[model samples]
Target chain A: MTQSVAMTINGRRREDHVEPRLLLVHYLREVAGLTGTHIACDTSQCGACTVLIDGEAVKSCSVFTVQANGRQVTTIEGLAEDGVLHPVQQAFWNEHGLQCGFCTPGFIMAAAYLLKQNPSPTDEEIERGLEGNLCRCTGYENIRKAVRSASQAMNGTAAEPSAQLVGSAAAPVED
Target chain B: MITAPFEYARPGSVDETQSLLNKYGSDAKVIAGGQSLIPLMRLRLSQPTALIDIQGIPGLNEVRRDNGSVEIGALVRHVDIQRNAMLRESLPILVEMSNDVGDNQVRNLGTIGGVIAHGDAAGDYNAAALMLDAEIITNKRRHQARDFYRDIFTTALEHDEVVTAVRFPVSTGRFAYTKFRRRLYDWAIAGVAVQETGSSWRVGYVNLATTPRRGSAVEAALAGGASAADAAAQSGSDIDPTSDVRATAEYKRHLTQVLTVRTLQKATMAA
Candidate 1:
């Protein structure tokens, strides 16, 4: 029950024979071997498996790999170019946005998509835009700050995020 | 959670899609955005033997005006409807309803035709379609909004019938949709949709019964010169709603009245 699927992932074409039932999250993590996309919930309630399909944010776990055939996908791993962090990735780093880091990829991808559509989003717009991504730690205060910072960077208005903003990680790594 | 194994088909045409439906019969399911069906499949609530992906079908995603109505192809995603300037100008209620559908990701990939075809009682589009008096166009023929929905999660679409588009008469009056949910992205416990046509109001309720309910009694009351509160007070009398995890039957009935009033007032204000 496997079909040949060919699509561009992380700006590179990837082809594989996969099951029709294989979720896109598994395709990105297993077949494509990009593990930054985490799967926290199989029910699609959690946004941990979010990614960009044709430049729009979507829940990869809810999308079948076969459904994404011949489409372009951008995972969290695809955000950075060469050795430099994407503005979103750097904002999360400098703003102490990651709590456990398990949900970091999903948050970053959602925020990136948000900024793509609204480069100068208001706080309410940011809250509404990123409401799909949940953060059990940081109470989403720092995550909201990170998205604001990223918006400023994407809009080319802000200098480097202040070093003082990176006071402490939101939550300790469980491992 | 992985879905049960199923054969897949990407039909390029409506005839091909219907033929695939005929080939697979009742065992096959046609998927548009896969927003609702995919989650159900992953949870094993729906396990079709074959999935016919209709995203590749040609000319099934256009949103254009025809005659005096706006025709929306089945593959028109929520975001598409939400962002279309023409639709925004002509049918802002639809845009408002689409905006309230789900979070950003859901709206991006979820199709208008898919949700309408799903016929979920709590789905926002059903109430919109009901209030708008939309025409559900399928491969076979057009089904009137009042005749399209059979029950909760049921529609007039046969196993092999493919919904091609929906036609909504161009609206030229105030419209509003209000949903009451536990969270921003959750399904509505009870929702209200109000649309004005000429001198009368067309009202509909979501999740208040097995099918999306029209506020016939409320519409009658409004037509009889009743105030918004008085019209909305008749809301609970027109439909039946059951208790669920979201709320008690009494609470849903209460919400039905309150949301109906709020939507009517908002719609009036917009007028």
Candidate 2:
């Protein structure tokens, strides 16, 4: 049987009739049409389906839509506000954190939540914070840099964007 | 992946949850956070006909100090336990174990009671609970932490029972946890938790057998005044480990020895 579940998503209250078995990732992608949250691995091993539920990061695929009723969910699409990129998204762009971009949104959401909780995370904290997310292409040096840059940017000291732009551009050109 | 069709009920109170469980019996599964069970459902490994969603129940998500023990509600999320000041101060072993449980997302979604009740041998919570000598309080019966685990994926919980809270006695001792894993989020091939009391040490081992078991041989050797390194060598002597994709039995035995010694030394130094 389908159950009616309601939640506040990105400042908007939404209601949908979902199967008790419907995963929160599918609900966000299909019912809410928020495709910014990608599902890279169907298993819980991949953090590509990460989102902020009640201001905490959680694996959307591991949660049922019905279980999320009455909660606040913020996907990668909701990270930005007022036509400006969130500090995490901007940091990823500034640090060249994405390769194929499949894992960017999840990393951005996870990093945003991490920075919100820890505005000045150390390199070890950043590594532990992003341990769940897997990037097959970028080799993680840029992701780690992006997380540090995002932490700094959130603390009002933004990094130089041009250096990473050159690096990102040069890598694809070399390929 | 679609989960098997199941009925759903969101209970508002623990009494209501107990009644639902009594009604549905084994056909129903109690879902709190759904980090482990949902994945199992998606794989069709568990096909319960109904799920009693207890996340809405009040008074079941608190971590409070009572008398001489810290009481943790069954619905308390791992992240909450990890950040709880009292739990961190009183039972940091639990906090450290919670930190190693999956990653941030999994910890945020997984509940301590769910992890313990799920009873996976590789689960981090089982080792911590065993090491801390916590008590698993259920609606039907209360069990000592050591008596709660019966086997892999099996607990002392009755078909109609639900874990309400867990109580861990406060101690001024030192503890340490060491696990050997291939990746950050992967399960440990073998792990050890050491708790040093006034003059004795309690050792627990994980992923070395079908259930979380005390390293009785090591504990006995330590109690007999053997050196920590020599005692730790007997870590897997009393238990049978299985070979899985993660590691062979011989490798797991070796890891148990190494991790046991390291954990014991760390706990001793902390003491």
Candidate 3:
């Protein structure tokens, strides 16, 4: 049995009859044909399927398609403007954020959300903000740099992150 | 990565949700945020045949002041709590704790009622709620935080019941939540939540036992003018620490004591 769900994906109204158990990540890839949202861990750990639902970053794999029925979803494929890249994507490209590129889309989406939330995050804040998304390539230095660069591009001034948000950033990032 | 095939219903009201739960019985599960349940479902650890999504239930997403307590709706997301000006002003510890939850993405979807319902020992909110003497209000009746937790991953909630809101006594008191974890987004290995209600102190431990345990012995020690170190030395009085993948029993005991000192110092010194 399938449930009819209609949601706006990347500003385009999409309607589909999806199984009740289908994950949002699978719906985006299989049904919507937007494979830019990768699913590396499939579990919620890797954040490889991260996307913006209603302008907030969420792990697509953890949300059922029916749950997002009336929401707006913005995947990595929906980030770029006509013939131009989003600031985070451009910063990732400029700073060489990924080596294998498998985790880049997730990183970009996570970074996009982070910049939107804290447009002037410090290095430690960036690290804490993107901890959900992992890079098996161990290219975190560049990823952090890419986020730092993204903040500069979007806000035009990279002031220090607010003192309140500066928490447990000194804490470990181990698995 | 998909949950087991299930029937889905997005009920617009709690009454409709209760009816769906009655129709599905034990096979039905209430999904508020689905952060914890969906992950388990993807791993096939939990395979509920029916999902009762309570997101469409309106008026359950706000943190409002009612009488002498603050009422946080069951559908209030962690992200909302973290960024909520009301909670940040009245219950700053919750904002701090909410910020340290799984991650930004997890916070964006996870809800306080869901966390309380899931009852993961490592989750941050259970200890906070217990330490604050919060009340768990369900569709059926009000349950005290002390009796709501049965065990790890277990709560007093019935299959046909759903949490409607959590009532925390209005407090701008000094409090601190310190979670010890190996990773930024990882669950707490052992954490402490200390909140001051009037002249007394309530201390709660996270992941120290099968349930969130409050340390009355530590509180008594504090009341008796025991030093921070001495009060924290009584941490083992109320809770039992176990050897887990995070740390050994002895290490968790020691860490709990040390963390208790830090948590206490943070709580008292704040005001």
Chain A TM-scores, per candidate, are 0.90, 0.89, 0.89
Tens digit of lDDT per residue, candidate 1, span B89-185? 7777889888888789888889988988899988888887887889999999999998988977999989999889989888868888888887788
Q: Residue A85: error of model 3 in Å?
A: 0.5
lDDT of 2 at A155: 80
TM-score attained by chain A of model 1? 0.90
What lDDT is reached at residue B3 by model 1? 84
RMSD of 1: 2.8
| Candidate 1 wrongly placed segments (more than 4 Å) | A160-175
CA shift of B52, model 3, Å: 0.3
The fnat scores of all predictions, in order, read 0.81, 0.92, 0.94
Which digits, one per residue and each the tens of the lDDT, describe model 2 over residues B46-75? 999999998888888988897888989999
Candidate 3 ranges beyond 4 A from true positions = A157-175
TM-score sort, best first: 1, 2, 3
Q: Which ten residues in a row have the lowest lDDT in candidate 1 chain B?
A: B262-271
- TM-score of candidate 1 to 2 decimals: 0.96
- lDDT tens digits, residue span A1-175, model 2: 7899999999899988989888899999999999989998888887999999999999899888898999999998787666466777767777788899888888888888888889999999998998889997855898989889878767867656643443344333210
